[model samples]
Target: MFLAILASNIRLVSHWSESRGVYDDICYLRQAHLFQRFGWHGLDTSLAHETDGYLAGKLRSIDFPNWNEPTRAPCHTEIADGSKWVMTPPPGTGFVLALFPEGFQVIPLYALANVMIGGFALYGLWRAREAGSLTLAALFGALSITFMINPAKASYSMAPTMVVCALAGLVTARLFVDEGRRRLMMIAAVGILLGLSASFRIANVILSAGYFLFFGLSFLIWRTRETFVAGLTLGLAFLVGLLPVFAANLVNSGHPLVSAYGGQDTAAPHLDPAVLRAYLRDTQFPLMVIACAWTALLWRFANHAGVRQLTLLVGANLALNLAFFATHPVFTPYYIIPILMLSLWTLLFAAVFTRGPVQGFDRAPPGRPRPPEMLSRV
Candidate 1:
């Protein structure tokens, strides 16, 4: 499965040219060019700094209207003094591309990503040691690898976002299943992954909504110092991982927290029949249905309290993500893919998924009142 997916991704990306129909690709490449040339100072993506004509050439390649005008470029929005125009998406995607030499970035970027995700699939295979479990794992792994090409290919930022979602999914399973000193470490790791995802696509932060809900509920219901510290650690780690985006925001928008995106991208979401139809017509919707169905099935018949909690988290994440995008005015081919992928991956590795002993949160003796604080000790 790994080799097949790797070869497919390599062949697909091999034919891909730097200049394509997507204008967003050009902006991402231009951002990479800026970073490659200016180092950390490249965070300021003002058009005035385009002294080399690289951005112009990329724009002209696509025959973009008014290629010479910086403000007219797609995905580049004007901010502050009508001079500093920047791409709405954060610089992480560009920064990843900037790591490679010019004219040889995209293929390598995607190839390496295939390796990472494939390795993850293999890890899932290893985790499912039984025949029935292994068959389910194998099918899910194949679908996951195949998914890397469909909706995952709609945008360059999605490459990194997909990788982050897969890793976070695995860690999320551990977050619910594993009990002991490693729990705090896993929480921090998940937090860092969540924040790092935002650097690729600002909306990717929504990927953490489920974790936020789960952690919040656990703390509120249990009211324990452990849960409190866990939630605090997750929040702080996310801020730390989000530093690059904060730096970019500070450099581009003149505010660390304020986003550079404006116009339709930031407009308040409202129901649109056309947008709704588009989602239903796309592969994203079916993937979402599968995720929701799997969550519901697990919620109904799961044997372990840990798996139940994980399922609940998956449910919350799905509900929040779907609600946000369903009402969004603009629709994209891959907008909701990340959340769907995240939910699927988390479900695949759910701890105590098989029928067995229900050893989860230790219970208080029947004669004594059960302490609510024991809920998230895992």
Candidate 2:
């Protein structure tokens, strides 16, 4: 199932034109080129050149076969030098894209990378599932890949990041079940992956923050030495993964913590309150339905750690989306996608949770041990 989904994504990305209709695809591709020529220290002047039509006019037809002068839209920010303007969006996606050679078709490479991350996500889900329920693991693996290859986001940067976010979220939930050295290792893995996800899209930092709180509270409630060490290790690994982005910000924006996005005026009209309200209205109907069903199931299986953490993950992302819309009214369908993915995963967990324990499955299976340091009480 994973292979099939990955193949589909590869086919989809392979066929995409270099200059597609998606707003940020070209920007990332251009940024990738800039990164190839100049690493994180120097700014990419091509953005400014594109803005002024000089780059578009001079960019070779052979190089940019699909370049549309009338539809050409180049994004630039005023935070850096005019000649060295960088796109306001985060450079994480571009950095991955930088691995590809100039003028080479990148969507396939991008799709391939997403599949690798999706594999990690599927493995994490499988590892975390209760014993004797191979069916559930298979179901989740299929569902995750289906979401990954969804045709709606064929050319969007959000596609890969969504896969990464799903993996990180699943790894985080797994930390609750595993124990001792294994859980600590998972903590390090989660931090590193979450950091990578944040690079693709900075909004993922909210998800990372959500995980930190979730782990921290678990430690506080348990007050165990293992949990304390686990939390600190996770935090440190996450910071290490984020080092590149921090360094880039320091060099490009002269502030280590401040991001390139800070330079953009998000309060612009397209992203104002009215559009946010409309998006909010559109999403409420579906959410209301999910909430009703989700609450009933939770009441029945409130003891299950999976159920609780899934709720937190989905709720955190939903709140993040809502906060963004409330503050900046401009909306894009992609922004709601991570919420949708988490919601679907939550619904899946609710199904398994409400079913009660599968018959004949041991609480601690032979291959998977319930270590002494496991959060048995929580």
Candidate 3:
């Protein structure tokens, strides 16, 4: 199933690359190429020359270099033909590109990384199931991937980061759910995964914050805060987990919180509050329906501890995604990461709901007939 999904994604990306005349791909490809040639710090000179050279080459190749004089901006130097001058690739993406050896095509490398990340997410789900049950685990994993693997959205520029975030979320969830004596280690591990997710996309810092709050609250509610030891332990874990993202942002953007992709004003015009609200209302209606459907499906098995955990995770992720839509000017497909995460948990809960009754039947008295199968034979 994983291989089939990956093959489909590859085919989709190939079709999009050839058929779509969009410039974002070229811009990202160029950034990847430049990163491969000159490390991150070396982007300045090469970016300028490459931008000019690409434009000049495009003009010569297409026989219309001077055709759109006003449309061409000077700052658009780092991108490929048809790309906007001011647009820049995300630093994390640039770093990924830099990891590739010279002469390797950047697009394929980036796509491959996205594919592998998806695989990692599946593996994490399987691991979660190993700690519990396969049906439940597979359900969650498939739903998450389904949300992400939609060709229309998944083939976009930010897909890699989205894949990374999903995998990180899965790993974090697995760490928390799996029973273990190494409480401190598990907390630290969750933090590290959250940090990695934030590094991929700065907005994921909000998800990390959510995780911290959820964890602290869960601990308090469970009455596990007997000692200052656990509180101090969680604090250190949070700090350790955030260090990677904070350090990367500080070193790359000179701001601990800011990402390479600037705010709404820098990227595009901000929508007015009224306009944004209307747009949100329109967009969120369908998402809310999906969320409710998922919840209803999961609610059937809410008696299980795992189902309950997944429910909370999905609820928190939905809240975060909606909160983001309320404040942010620009909305992109990548912002659906939280939604995708929630979808995974929904899948898991559905799986558990479906399987729970079956298990209960299996444990019924030997003389009693099995309950009518709710699901059709496999």
The TM-scores, one per candidate, come to 0.90, 0.70, 0.64
Can you rank all candidates by lDDT, best first? 1, 2, 3
Per-prediction tally of clashes:
0, 3, 5
Worst 10-residue lDDT window, candidate 1: 351-360
lDDT of 3: 0.50
Which prediction has the highest lDDT against the true structure?
Answer: 1
Structure candidate 1, residue pairs in collision = none
Task: Give the whole-model CA lDDT for all candidates, comma-separated.
Answer: 0.84, 0.60, 0.50
Which numbered prediction scores highest in TM-score against the true structure? 1
- Candidate 2 residue lDDT tens string, 1-378: 767776776777677666545456666776676677667643433343344343353234335543544234455465544334456556777777777776673665557665765675466455444553346556656656655545335545666676665656555555543344587788898888877766777776655655677678879999999769878998999998887677767755677797767766665524465665666676443643564456455545667665566566455545555565456555555555554554555444444433445444447767786666453432
TM-score of 3: 0.64
Model 3: residues >4 Å from true position, as ranges? 1-5, 15-27, 40-89, 101-157, 218-288, 292-300, 306-310, 342-378
Model 3: weakest 10-residue lDDT segment is: 73-82
